[model samples]
Target: MTDASLPARFERPSALAFLGYAAAIVIILWSFTGAGFSIDKVVSSPPRFADFLDRAFPPNLEPQVLARLGWKMLETLQIALAGAVIGITLSVPVALLAARGLIAPTWINQIVRTALGFIRAVPDIAWALVFVVAVGLGPFAGMLAIAIDTIGFCGRFFADDMEAADKGSSESLTATGARKLDVVACATIPAAMPAFISTSLFATEKAVRSSTILGLVGAGGIGIELKVGFDLFDYPTAMTVILMIAVVVISIEYLSGWARTKIIGVVR
Candidate 1:
């Protein structure tokens, strides 16, 4: 082959790229130090973990224990379902308002987007504590926490989907003397509905996972039962509770994955 026809030698990344990588490493190390990371503590972790395992052996397989765990798991799943429904219902309109391409008013879109941000800022666990204070414990608090988080989680994505919708359809409808609401209903919403449904399904799965931990704040679910086991130093029971939760979570995850595939033709 002629020298001119030879492929150019593959070049290494520039020094600037290496410098950027070095800077990122430095920042990560600095943050790790500030957070008090320690190799010595990590090295000593396995024995403590082993002791935990020793205590957690011989899982609690009693009928009453199994029944209680089953009931709590059911409660958690119900809370997640209810929260997802409530959140998706509430998010749809807000998501529409936040879609800048659909809503021409810049101020309104910005405000809606900002509100979604604020809603998503607080974690579900924190929201659970807040609701626990407001509602005085039980599944209701967890439901509300999950609902609020779902609104944030699904709304932002739904808004983006709405915004990403083809403008030509919306414009064509509007040109035919269609009102703004009609235009969105006929053009944007239908286009985005599948994506919205898929997002809601994912959000429901996320809520199911969050529901497990809400019991930490006495909001309700299997977490409270697990807490009691740990508090009593009943590691066998705790392990049983953990396994029960794992089974339920995995089962629901599989079910949701299958549903998503059927409905949206996507696994995730």
Candidate 2:
């Protein structure tokens, strides 16, 4: 094809494009002002941060404190694990309903998609607060919040993964006199299992991180300890809690990554 026959590589942006860009810039500036962004505060923050570090040094090493924190951490892990399992289990069926042209009708798919979106729109912390009020502030409430959050996280990805699975195998199953559910069971779900596992691992990691802070709202975990330490100016204990949370969260992330690689590799 001659250069003259080719389409132009660059064209002037439309007036609407310029208007959109200007609007984006204005919104950013407005957000900065609304969020109370201050150059002076940023410049003056170092000394205050240093003071925090000074007071937080020499983390509490008391055997009793360690034992107490250990139990709380264990509770947090339990909450995360139980919640993730429940959510992931529920997500499979919900995802099937949300997967367009899978086992569910178009209207069912739309409804399920909308419900998943609504679930994801609300923050997990807000869910925790709601559950705390409902369940009277305990590990159970935290677990419920994590479960709901995981459902939102896993359901969306699971549905997309199933929808993107190899259509050839599913079609073959359907053409062999298989029912819609049979086709999904024999072909679609198997094809999407690896992605489902990966998403579940990610959901578990997220639940762990969220559960750590759920205690701040009295939903049960090390967060309550951290809050109490800060409230009483027990910097050493607070530092210990912070360190523990960091270690656990990072460890879970690394483990999740390793599992994803190994499991997906094996599946492939």
Candidate 3:
């Protein structure tokens, strides 16, 4: 195609884009004012932070403390694992149901999508608190919260992947004697499997991070221990716990990312 024959560009910035930017700026300014935000206070807070950090020096990385950290770390992992598994199990069907490629029924797809959206709308900590109320304070609450969060994350991920999958394969299967479920199982699911696994790993990493804070709501994990150290004015111990959390989070992120990358490589 000649330059003149080439289609017009779709997204040259226009008044709508300018208006959106203006609205965003206004909203950002309003948000700061509404929340009584003060950049000056933030700048002034560094000394207080420095003092706190100074007090947190020589973290109590004693053998006993490290051992406790190891145990709590294991508990956090277990909670994340349980939640990821449960969330994957629950999310898969909803994802399949919401996948427009497989499910042509608009109402059904909308319903499933809306339900997943509702779950996704709630923050992990809020859900943790709710679960703590329902299940009592323990890793159980953390597990439930993580599960809900995973469902929220992975469900949408899976559904979007499924929707975007090559409909040709699934359509071809449907053209044969395949049932709707068979079409999805044989074609759509397989096409999206790698993406689903990768997304699930991402969600699992998020769950692990969130699990630390869930303990604040009595969801059972290292967070409770951290809170305890903080409440006792044990800055060294709290710092230790914080370091432990950072270590685990980084470790999980690296490990999961490596695994996902390897899997993608293998699949390709």
Candidate 4:
């Protein structure tokens, strides 16, 4: 075959690409340095981990233990619900402001986006720690933490969905001399409702899991019990608690999926 007609063979990566790969590798190695992630350490830890696993195998299913776990699980769900409610309610205004086509004044949109970014920068656990200090421990702190975290994520996602909605309906509403709020309420919200519901459900599922961890810092939930079990070296109790959490999370996921189908209608 003619050289021009032949497919290229063994094309070399560019110098910049090679340098980028080297830099990435260096950064990864540097990160591990502080992490104390030697192969020897990893190998040595397996025996300790195996011993823990042996202890955890027979899960404690005592009635008192189960009852306490059930109550804590309910508290975790309550925290998640409260956070989801507050976060979704508070997100509406911010999301509306952040929607480009919905809201005017470029500076206002910039400010809203910046604030959302700032809120999203912190992890939920960090927020939980802060609120635990402020509120003096309990599900209140967990609720607040999840609310703040969800506001940042859900509001941004909702705003993006809103901006992508069909402008024709909103324009028609405006032509009829509908006020801005009326236009949004009548036109924009319906178009975005399915997406909004889906996002809220997903956020709620995440919040439920996060609420469990918030208890590590004194925010009330199953995490406190899990921490106690761990502290007391009661691996079986800890394993039971972990399994219960897994069950709850899986149940929530299944319910959310069903609800999403109902909200969005059956997908073909």
lDDT per residue (tens digit) for residues 168-233 in model 1: 888899999999999998999888877887888889889989999899889898899899999999
Clash numbers, per candidate? 0, 0, 0, 0
Alpha-carbon local distance difference test for all models:
0.90, 0.94, 0.88, 0.90
Ranked by TM-score, top first: 2, 1, 4, 3
Between candidates 2 and 3, name the one with more favorable TM-score. 2
Comparison by TM-score, 1 against 2, better one: 2
Candidate 4 structure quality by residue, lDDT tens digits, 1-268: 5567766887787999999999999999999998988999888999999999899999999999999899999999999999988998999888999888675577888889989999999999999999988988899999999999999988898998898878889999999999988999999988888888888888898998898888899888889999999999999999999999999999999888898888787431
TM-score of 4: 0.91
lDDT of 3 by residue, 1-268 (tens): 5566756778677999989999999999999899989999999999999998999998998998899878998899899999989998899987877877575588888888898899889999999999989989899999999998898888888999998877889888888889988888899989988888888888888988998888887998889889999999899999998998999999998898789878875421
Give the Å shift of residue 222 in candidate 3: 0.6
Candidate 4 lDDT: 0.90
Specify the highest-TM-score model's number.
Answer: 2
Q: Compared with the true structure, what per-residue lDDT tens digits does model 2 show for residues 107-165?
A: 99999999999999999989999999999989999999999999999999999999999
The ten-residue window of minimal lDDT in model 4 covers 259-268
TM-score of each: 0.92, 0.94, 0.90, 0.91
Question: Best lDDT goes to which candidate?
Answer: 2
TM-score of model 2 vs. true structure: 0.94
Q: Candidate 3: global Cα-lDDT? A: 0.88
Worst 10 residues of 3 by lDDT: 259-268
